[model samples]
Target: MFGSIWQYVYTNFLRYWLKWFIRQVTGKCELQRICSDYTPGASRTTRAENSLQASKNKVLRGALKTSRDHVEQCVDQIMKAKNIKPQKDPLFKGSLHICLLQITGYSSLYTSVEELRKEVFSSENPEHEAMLLKLWGLLMPEVKLECRITKQWGDIGFQGDDPKTDFRGMGLLGLINLVFFSENYTAEARQVLSHANHPKLGYSYAIVGINLTEMAYSLLKCGALKPHFYNTVQGTPELKHFHQLYCYLAYEFDQFWVAEQPESIMLFNQYREKFHDKVKTHLQDPDVSLTLTVGSY
Candidate 1:
């Protein structure tokens, strides 16, 4: 037992030390490697040694950003890419699958694709409540919650006076959170509005339906929403790969993670490509600024 405890402690302690070491070394302004802006694989300079120490893994910085900004940028980029009007083609049925493909490191299993459709999406499965609990653990991981086995509380998702509400998936109104909690909780992310109230966050028949009128109005303003919705999923592997990225963006919007992605020349170059002439002509654009920092977490 002592040995096990020692191993556990050693692993966590080492990881903590590793984070510090990476921050200490690369925190300097000299080597400006962007994109993979991280506190890992950092090297310390030594005079006599004439070499820098190395870290095992590297982190990419600046992954998250303000939602409003993200929405606008996404709109601009999508528009600039092409005038391709987004239509709800049957081919792209599983939009989540495409989004999930991008989310590699992040995983919220309780709401896995299967579970999402079954419990959260279709919500026919009586065990959906249990699944929601599991997903909450993965996404929020900060809110402490208790799972009551009995339906004494009535249907899953929504928790309120209305028993008529099957409340399959609540979205913004503390729906997913009816599940579990984690140590790395960012409470500000909590949504006061109900996602079940929005069609974009559609769950099941028992849940609320998205209002087409409001969605159409939103589409004109936010073009990214169309592309996001058009995705159903052509291939499994490729779609799932991107879903992770999509989900991460949907869920996590922390300032700290942004300053930690790979921002190396190569990476930035790609970003530049994505940003196009914005970097070429107006690199000094007002929006441009150094993002990575410590303790923003």
Candidate 2:
């Protein structure tokens, strides 16, 4: 009860006075101080975002929702509202512009990812069917699929004869990530598949890939990937960046699963949670860059 009251008091009352005092002492607004004090990337951008969200000024708060094309104008508006002159602080405009881009870009990236996740995989779509075939060819170059709806799908780690049913939970997002890893990191994807085919220690490759997609999606939806994207991509993050992150998860999770040598596939959830926790811990660092690095094929 007291904590809630204190938070309300702090947010509504004490915060503005504190900002006023700090600005008077330092001659810098919260945003300016944020950009100047912290170096670029997540540390600067995340703090700027938080400061904007807490601002009572409409322009400052609205800057968080500014579109990509209008980011420069939004930064101008913020400067005009705050009375920050380019002559006095030349770097502020560019720094704040980049911060706004990262902030708004995170939201935009999530929208794109969510749309893909909601797009159901359809056998009727030629593009979708082609992607599935491409994934098979990439992973299994030596063996041709006997048929589109055969047990060969199981050899690549789908749950049943047909692979389409396995995509129900994650939709097209799952398929795209699976194909992305195979397409970009062919050798690594095939190596992971080989590990998955190890009779006793083997787990379903495609199913687990989809499961890792969910893991990536969850981290993204919760804003846990902000540090990673901000640190890695200088400009706006796109869908391909998200796919690349999935590749990291897919490769790392396979290595993790093999190293542990669990009793059975039934213990997947237990180990999955452990790996999720490990990834979350890494994301807590401001310098986190979760990229998949391996030798070239």
Candidate 3:
């Protein structure tokens, strides 16, 4: 009896005291407000429920000034005190809280994408060469290509002979997204590649895929995809989540192209712009999913 009482009291002490500690260190006014609103004598369940709701309201109102990392740490501390799982916790799983985390996650992801954009993919880097080969192998498992950087790159999807020149704009990020999609969903990736090679409506597969990466990045930056991210993701998003978004765009755009029935690849930009506008409109809704329903096409 005494142990249980002591444990409960100690848990509350930590939860209540940490708010003041956070306020003094971070100077986040919203945390101060949340801490001050705690009602003493409330049951532990009630306290947790109230705190989670208050945090969500603050997040939605744009009143929370605390950084995502700090908030995440706070949640960790609370969960440890309460002996609860993170994903099962009400605070982190709430839509508004996830929305805030998504914002922070997107900022970090965009910075990474920007850094990758600046780096020119080089064959000298063993990792880059390995990834390039892995990408080709994942897409064309049956046909083996030479290890040397040569025109054989065209056998997959590069514009010219050497695939290295093709990474000028999107750089390593584009290649990584392409590789991620192919490695995770080989069949769907091959189908998309086949569509890109259509006799009449054929487009440059790698080039179009990279362009879609730019589009995905742009949507994330402008907050157009917030609705989708906020609702679908129950916790902090990650780089793989961004890559997944790119995969969706790459796959869906191929379907869009084939459906549009354009006369030739010459009309790509026109159809591409149309598809972009459609995505923007979908994002305008507060409940957009934008999930890729890939199948064995």
CA shift of 212, model 1, Å: 17
C-alpha RMSD of each candidate structure in angstroms:
24.4, 1.2, 12.7
Worst 10 residues of 3 by lDDT: 38-47
Q: Give the per-residue lDDT digits (tens) of candidate 1, residues 1-297.
A: 999998787665865576557647865211122112321111110110111112222211111121322433433342233232235222121221222222211122212432433333334544554564554454335555544333322222334433224433332222332221111222322231122123343222112111111222232133222222222222222323223222232233222123334333234334323333322232233222221122112
Q: Can you rank all candidates by TM-score, best first?
A: 2, 3, 1
User: Ten residues in a row with the worst lDDT in model 2?
Assistant: 288-297
Which residue runs does candidate 2 get wrong by more than 4 Å? Answer: 295-297
lDDT of each: 0.29, 0.94, 0.68
Which regions in candidate 3 have their CA more than 4 angstroms from the true location? 1-66, 72-99, 295-297
Per residue, candidate 3 scores C-alpha lDDT tens digits across 25-114 of 755333223333432211221233335544423332232344676655544444354344445434432423344455455556667777
User: After aligning candidate 1 to the native by TM-score, how far in Å is the CA of 149 from where it should be?
Assistant: 8.9
